[model samples]
Target: MGFTDFFSDVWDTFSHPSPDADAGGKASTNTPSSGTDEESGDEKDVNKDDAKDGEDSEQGHKPSGDDDEAEEEEEEETVDPKDELEEECRNSQGCAQPKHHFDECQERVTGQIESDGKAKEDCVEEFFHLAHCVTSCAAPKLFAQLK
Candidate 1:
């Protein structure tokens, strides 16, 4: 099945769960009666034809490989701009000093915790300093891109 259909089925299964859902969370395979014997036989014939055509008869749809690949490519190509900007700013020269300070503080705090079974001080302040620097550097670029 296609992605949206799969998700829709999942949502339906959760939101309107069957009474016969087992303790293991699996719903019972017994489908409710829909029609008479002749109608069921007609449906079976259609299902057999669909199976011969290499289509997913149960889902009532077949996904093309090209469409699936194109969708995946588009998803992969669309990176969140804010995340990209933040990563760039963090690695930039303007934020390097604060990042280095945060790194050193983190190492010192971790070492103290390992040796003394507790840390005398945390790296929160240094981390905030680094965060502030990166945010300041990224904000202008991010806004520029938005404009």
Candidate 2:
């Protein structure tokens, strides 16, 4: 097996989770303990208190120094705007606006043209110039064709 497979196997061992792992994806037995209700109630109260504290913090510009930094890191991890826009254009078959549909197609093509891991400043300038020409040329033809 590869390095990833080995790492996965090791992780799977510690987790010991069954096929249908819970939402948290941790293993747990269904056996009820003596302090279950009390523990659960305490947890609920803690969650409520946490939520209230979070709300109060939101009202004020509290400098959650590392937490705010961590949130920014999470945002970077979650979505790439370029990739998302390309996917949107690629998967668009039932888009409503005619101009927008064409624009999406143009965007995807332009995106691929700059997929060489290069910066987009040059590509954006070229795309804007080309788009302006295409729009100016196509609109009159479209109007004439429709009439």
Candidate 3:
């Protein structure tokens, strides 16, 4: 593929997510139940275990008050690194979009490149800088890909 296509694909990977990832790379909870759920048998076994273990003591069972704190810990544990990074990048891009639009708005931006008594190399440099500036405003990570 050409440079532009490759660059676009890279940006897409960052903005969206890799299909190979299962919900932020977490293992799916698809338990294969041979289509026959033995709820009665399972409940009977669980009741026996609970009775044998006794209410106050079996193993590492945290109490209700401590469970509130544990729930908070579980919530923190569920954070997805990829999702966090992508959202952070998207927020930065959102903040930059309007400014980038102003910097690279069509009429003004074109005039910026061709007009003025700027040399060809200078004009090209300025154009690239303009492009970079605009992308940085909306998507700084995308701007980095161009370099």
Candidate 4:
């Protein structure tokens, strides 16, 4: 990746709001907010048009009636990572496999030292090993062949 792409990704990680928050990064439902106001206005317009057409024709159309349902479905399909992160934060969890793998690696290495009665004091070396594990696991496809 280029420098710009790297920086942008880093920036987005810190800048975006988390998803698991109760508000879902949206304005509060109780507030007479501009965002909901706009949505309501659009829905009202569609409803009015549908009502007019239905009255004029023998066949009736439900305009805004189905729009809300469709939007709900779309929202369910497209989840934001920030939202997921927020949810994980709330639940005291991290992204799954990598965190577990990191803990496993530390435990396995320490266990070996204990079995051998060897004192482990190489902090710098351990840092590099863990760092490699993290970055490699982050992009498994790129590192798969090396495995």
Name the candidate that leads on TM-score: 1
lDDT accuracy of residue 53 in candidate 2? 91
Off by over 4 Å in 4: 1-94, 119-147
lDDT (0-100) at residue 144 of candidate 2? 65
> How far is each candidate from the true structure, as Cα RMSD in Å?
14.7, 19.9, 20.3, 20.3
- By lDDT, the better pick of 3 and 4 is 4
Residue 1 miss distance in model 1 (angstroms): 63
Model 3 scores a TM of: 0.20
Candidate 4 per-residue lDDT over residues 60-139, each given as its tens digit:
46566788888787885655444444344333333444445556667876887889876454345555554554444444
Residue by residue across 1-147, what tens digits does model 2's lDDT show?
999999999998987756555668544564335556544666779988988899866655666798888888878455544444444443444322444645666676668667855434344544454445455545555566458
Ten contiguous residues minimizing lDDT sum, candidate 4: 86-95
Can you tell me which runs of candidate 1 are displaced by over 4 Å? Answer: 1-70, 73-76
Clashes of each: 0, 0, 1, 2
Instruction: Tell how far residue 34 is off in model 3, in angstroms.
Output: 2.9
Of the two candidates 1 and 2, the one with more favorable lDDT, higher being better, is: 1
Please report, in order, the local distance difference test score of every candidate based on alpha carbons: 0.82, 0.59, 0.58, 0.59
